[model samples]
Target: MEPENTTQNKPRGRVVMLVDNGVKGDSRVQKAARSAADAGWDVVLFGVSPDGEKHSWKVGSAEVRLIPKPGPLNPRRHDMRRPLFRRPLAYRSPQVARYRVQAVKAWRSDLSFRQAAVKAARAGHPGRSAGGSKARLLVPRVSSKVYSKWVALRARETTDLQQRRSMLDARLDRATTALWQGLMKQRSWRRLTPNLWDFELAFAKHIDKLKPDLIHAHDFKMLGVGARAAVRARAAGRPVKLVWDAHEYVPGLPPRHGRWLPGHVAWEKEHAVFADAVITVSPALAELLKKGHGLSQLPTVVLNAPVLSPGPDEVAGAGPVPDLRELCGVGPNTPLLAYVGGINPVRGVETIVEGLTQLPDVHVAMVSVPPGKPYAATATIRKLVDKLGVGDRVHFLPFVPHWQVAEFVAPADAAVSPLHHLANHELALSNKFFEYSQARLPQIVSDIRTMSEMVRSTGQGEVFRAQDTDDYVRAVKAVLADPERYRAAYDKPGLLEKWTWEAQAEILDGIYSRLLPDRPRIAAQPSGSRADARA
Candidate 1:
């Protein structure tokens, strides 16, 4: 660790922020890093590198470091105690015992042999020589009756044994599952997810070397990373404060197969209590986090609003924002609807494409994530578009800078947010909701609790049944018919201004100030001092 400057002018404490993404398009983390750096703290943001090599760049005053995230990538490999095939009883499927198989086969073989012997005896019988045909027939019939009774008795015994084995397997399975779940309650049980451990292995040493005064963990995965790092730093006699930024309500996220959902929920529950402070994107989320973590104070709310403009605190490098109508090859007279953010089924983007079939001359501009790369959801949406024969009307564009989203979509006739009625969607406002309002584009939002209520209350636009194509078409036409009336919602006092990143940054800065009052301010340093600075 760098020795503290002992001079009369002490350097401000350093802050390290951890995120699980590549950090190229994560507006919330970028905004937080820039805001903290502007407030005079030496901030370094760490993210997972897409490539194997480590890379670094400057996001305004904050230094962004992308650490290589090497992995086996499978959760099952993390458990040192068991091999892949030898999973715990609860995770393994029941197999028929070898003894039972052998026993059943032996009984069937004996019965076949007895039946053949009886037929041979009937064929060789004294047939009409002594007591004639009656004797031969009687002998075969008596043997057949005896053999049938024996087969019935053995079958009943085999059936009873099989039933007992099934009952035992069931009881054992239940017991093992209960035991595994009980073990998961302990913090050490996190080893089940090796990828998470890989994250810690990749970033912990770098974080420790920096000896940061504060660790701001973004989302659930980093919360554990930051919390554990803080514990290590404290043990080494360095005082490190921890801040957990809950990006979403983990329990409310869509269900995932295997251990993903429960593992993350457990991980969050374990580490959230260690945070000196917590911040989330919405008031509803904040309240849930407060109660869920049993924190004494409610988490500070920082909505993921768009940048009003490039201020001293905001980061640059998003490149030029494109104009929506020009990008769509549409004129002002043509009706255009815009959708931004990730492409997913739950996002309800299919509703928009399906709606286009009914509303001719209406074009859609969909801006998806990771810029140019094709993702699974993107492919699905494309297939739907092709199937519906609306390929010509829908224009798929790469995402613009987060701050520039509103400007990018400003020329569209109206913005549509057709998010499905998921729990997280219902409980919070989406980034597009605020972005559309900032552009003064009339909104066509789904009837999710938070967004629908906001749109209805503000009179910004109309709400439709989530994922209902017919209703979505109705809302889109309503807006297209009289966009002026819906656009008037922006005229309401402080509506747009209240939802900008600048407003949210103030609350963020205040939280920082309150948490680290004693920490001194670090003087601004040059960017090229780092060894890994991008060429």
Candidate 2:
């Protein structure tokens, strides 16, 4: 239930939400902004522009602005490129020095071999010995013995030099790797990947101008941005509240680069303290984040559940929700499985495609890749399907609007969440899990802890070993054999109601209300102040 807002009649406050994505498919941020707006707060959601250009739009009463954050300061590509904020060339370019040393050693090795050959040749020559014919002949025999020894010694020395050269190369490579890892372990690792700086530079000025009473930073990248902006507001005597919404555990995420894990962990550690309140996706994640950050208060768990609609057969939105079965060109009786979410290796999309080969009659609607966009995983999935010779059985489709996902995927016989067992995957019930439940589709989920336990406890569907093709086939066969039995799980009263964005939004509203009670607020920028002058 939504906490009673004692400040309901008071003037609504302005909120500036900062996220790190393009905001096109980010449902969590979209839902949060929309919920805040619906609760009578003026909301502006700022996100990084996908095409390095500005974009503006509206999500319900909330305003969305995509700021173009273009520069060499991307964490994914930071270490690969020349450092954006460079150190001294000698300090930065160790590869250059390593290569130079290897080249000189190679040159010296070659020169020694050549000089030894010349000396051996000279020693063997008869004319170089000062003596009579007998002595000359004897000298030739002795010189030949000496020259042979020299040749043997030189060959061994050359082999040793080459081996030493290889060892030196390997040593240097290890040294380089160690140096990088060491630097990332330090307190100032953020300087190496200055992408956060780029984000701050892009959004901070806009944040100041908005004069927001609250700053909602989505994920780790924006945590610092929101904190700095909140400090700026407070320093100017505006008293803005900061909320950090940690989407996932930083250490649990797949590291994009060598410095990605440690750098982000340190970054979040520094800025998370500034947040007046924290919001997270699941109870498990909330507990982990609380312990990880050692926060004064545990984070509020706001699930990424779909917004509940009035009718099951129809969506509340205006757009046409595509039929998953029709798109696959399969009839209602056909065994159809729907997989909704982004296409990635860890998502275990390959397990679903591979499993299709065993269930020949089964057709799958892969809503993996986004519409009209090039995703690398699309090709990977296609290659796997082609290799397995299941092209005709699979259908590739685009994503529907966030609110329509449950309705969009409802036509399929069952929904599959074959997510691989990663730390985050094991802990949380994915949005698709709730969406499938909302659609009343029997779930064929992976054996990852949370979703699997839910599936077993609720008797919603079958749980298979994650990434195990044979186990997935068995689970699919079980569900297709008696999907209605699994579907009956939805018949339980109020189960669907508990897993919804509306229910999650109530928790969000309460968090906002508790953080910023009934009070008068100052402008984010005061008149004749430096912030106003900059604006």
Candidate 3:
């Protein structure tokens, strides 16, 4: 079936979005694609595939093109063994030992295949002696098993050493991170640039073929990609526009080796000059991008709010929706605290798990989508839950579709955001905050500027000291103590209308309309509205 929002008539224009991550879990990219499609634009999304296989499929109103990376480097063909040889011998973790065993098996398999090919080629050659060919084949047959055993032993030793070093490095990560951050501050910003992965390079080449009228870069990583592609297209006489959607404060991102925040900030400053327009999720971040990047224009703020319900009754009656509670085997009266987002370290998931130990009556259902990195914080949180003996109180639900998130969360007594006070978290206005409002559920948020202001102004919930387990417990209890007072805040006239994505999407629609003034105009629709629910 044709995806929702896609027109039977010819599209007004084409827009290609460059998303570094896959399209499945990225709500921002999904929203952008839907918005563009609703406005009569044919949308194409370029993203990564886990396996090295190229493929295309329809996702809602957009065409998704996924490019995969090459498989692991072969030790025989490349310098992969050089690094292994350099490591000092030491004890190995069980995980590392198993990996080394697999690597050795693969290496031996490759060697066996090569030897078989050589033997086959000798049989076909006219000049080779039968005796000499038999000897060559016999030599490998006799020594191959011994050689494979020797290689396996060496791999185990090397992997053991690497695993030991990894353990040591983990202990010193904090000190090393601080030292690296200090060194990065002194280095020339010009020297820092994002290393383009093979898939990204392939994506850039693929984009050249599309020659889209507009290019929408999802986050900082794709800013340069989109800008460069637009420049190439414009140089070829195609009038292409570039839109940068800065999802977070790039300059204030957590410190890491090589790709420091300052370096990324500097790189983005240079690339922003190429963008025809800039877009961001929150007003606080928009202002930061304007001042930090020195953009000619202030970025339009497209808040990641929940889409509006069909009517007031839908919002009010959502609380009684039958979901999660029965599936999780929790009582109807049990105070269910819902947290819907990526379960990452910065989001303070550990604190939430820890705090649940103190709140015996309340249950927390973590409806988590995967973060940028696979299982970045989920493993740690699981370990903590087991250690704290709070497994019964803390439930984990697999990520649901964007439209179905409301149904899952609607049954909760309250929504929680115990995010740590990192630079990005402090200035952040996350989707969960508005989602709680949309579900008419009270919020329990971190005592940060943006979310605190939201709760205080709207009178929808309570905020406590960020990263403090006791404070979080108290804040959640305070809200649950008088649920009606907090619930009444969401019922205030016009509050839900303001927080809905239907209102927020208008800003996005306006930005595109202004960017392509000559294109045909279509009435903008909310992403995942009834007509587009099939997405």
Candidate 4:
């Protein structure tokens, strides 16, 4: 193939991706943004502001604006429903519980409204009882004494019904506000600030200012927001395709810590009906869409891949960041096991911690590169490290910037992910697994589907019984002794191929392509097994 005289940074379509701003330092988002920018999409991001700054939006090569989630009116919102007010009762906080009570009260209003309508019909009025002539005509003629008695009885009942209905109406109004709030939750109040409304104008307004051909919306968070923008553009008679990348079983899940709403499920189906194209990430998720819902018909499943060339220097420059022994205060020959990402129970961080106690010279440096909330639990993990007498070994790097991650984990003897025995964990495809390959660092992973199959297939790492701390410890010792012996397994020719964001964005590129078939088609279907794509 002849090399074309082209600049790598040629612009594509104007794209506006939505993510939490604090995740600016997260490698995944960074890679996604880089891929979109390199492909020539005028990309701008809208995330919660980092500082106390409010309502910020930027435009440029790849603009990143930090908008306050809890806006000027309500800067520190405790309810998640109101993007500006992100408090959720799911924390079971007194305030959240009060909101729950209010929710029940609001639903009761709907019931009351129905009752009011029935009573009104029975009284010979659809909305209210107007005794002008219709009321008198509806009632039968009788003696003055009998008629007076009937009128008195009816008036009392009418007054009681009206009072009850009025109360319910007020309650319903309040409940609607609370329920809507519970639907939009982020880890913190600030994170929810920029997402002020369910349909954010700032997002569409920013995108419109950029004016891209196709709008690719990831997750249901931006489904309606992006679709509405497409509708507005369409009304203006602009031919814009609204692409939805469905990452979850949206209708299958409910609002965070919210009671199931039959209406929410209906709403997702409605949104898909309106979208130009819907893209899904997983086959299972796609299958669920098809089987559980009639969404299999939509052209979906753009495999996560990279379209751009790998930065040779990133891998070439990939070397250990710190002296593992010195950083963790262990002896020169102590075993240093690394685990990246935030520490969470589901990811099996606790199991890793518990297993580490049994190993001699095993210092688990959990490079908490990325942090997410439910702070109380994260705090608890740090305490466990201290209480377990491994305080010196386990350290939480609450915030790890993207570039420096290479430096932190480069020197690790081996990396491990001891996830619990959950179906989700079995199919896990975390960045750590890929990063280990990139750095040539061997791994000791959980014996679940994706990680287990990966370890067994590639021999790049080892796997152990997921919850069995004893097995995890045994595997760690085996890998630390001779990681290179098993290196032949995972370091395949195309192993590093898909982990890059440039590759991953191709999946997005595929979804967007169907949206605008008339546009140029530069994407190609990659040759791989289903396991490879899933991994």
Could you tell me every candidate's TM-score relative to the true structure? 0.75, 0.74, 0.73, 0.62
Clashes of each: 1, 0, 0, 24
Greater-TM-score candidate between 1 and 3: 1
lDDT of 3 by residue, 91-161 (tens): 23444556766766775575566566666667784433322344555665556667557656766766655
- RMSD per prediction, one decimal? 11.7, 12.9, 8.7, 16.5
lDDT of 4 by residue, 1-535 (tens): 1111222343345566666445445445445555555445556655556674644322223456555444443322333232122221123233444454455555445445655665777777766432223344333323333544544444444444334433223454346535544564321221322333433544556556555567666666566667667787888878877767665565445243222223344345445656767666554566666665465474465443322333333334444345554666766576778887766666788888887688756777777744455445578787877888877777555434344444457677788877776644554455666666665678888887766786787788788887788888888878877877866655577776765554667766666556666656543322221111111
Q: Give, for candidate 1, the lowest lDDT window spanning 10 residues.
A: 87-96
Mark the regions of model 3 whose C-alpha exceeds 4 Å error after superposition: 1-11, 69-194, 197-200, 259-263, 308-322, 369-383, 524-535
lDDT per model vs. reference: 0.75, 0.76, 0.71, 0.56
| Location of the lowest summed lDDT over 10 successive residues in candidate 3 | 72-81
Model 2: per-residue Cα lDDT at residue 278: 96
Which structure among the candidates has the greatest TM-score? 1
In what order do the candidates fall by TM-score, top score first? 1, 2, 3, 4
Clashes of 4: 24
C-alpha lDDT (0 to 100) for residue 167 of candidate 4: 28
The C-alpha stretches of model 1 lying farther than 4 A from their native spots are 1-11, 72-177, 183-188, 311-320, 520-535
C-alpha positional error of residue 199 in candidate 1 after TM-score superposition, expressed in Å: 2.4
lDDT of 2 by residue, 1-535 (tens): 1122222343668888999998877888887887777677778889989988888877666678988886656523322444323222221133434454455556445444544555555778533223334343455455555654554454444444334433323454346445654676534446535566788898888889878889999999899999999999999999999999988888898765555566677778888889999999887888899999899888988888987542221232345666677788889888888998888888999999989878999999888667676688789889888999999998988777667788888888999999898998988788899999988999999999878988999999999998899999999999999989999999999998889887887788788888888833322211121111001
Local error of candidate 2 at residue 86 (angstroms) = 17
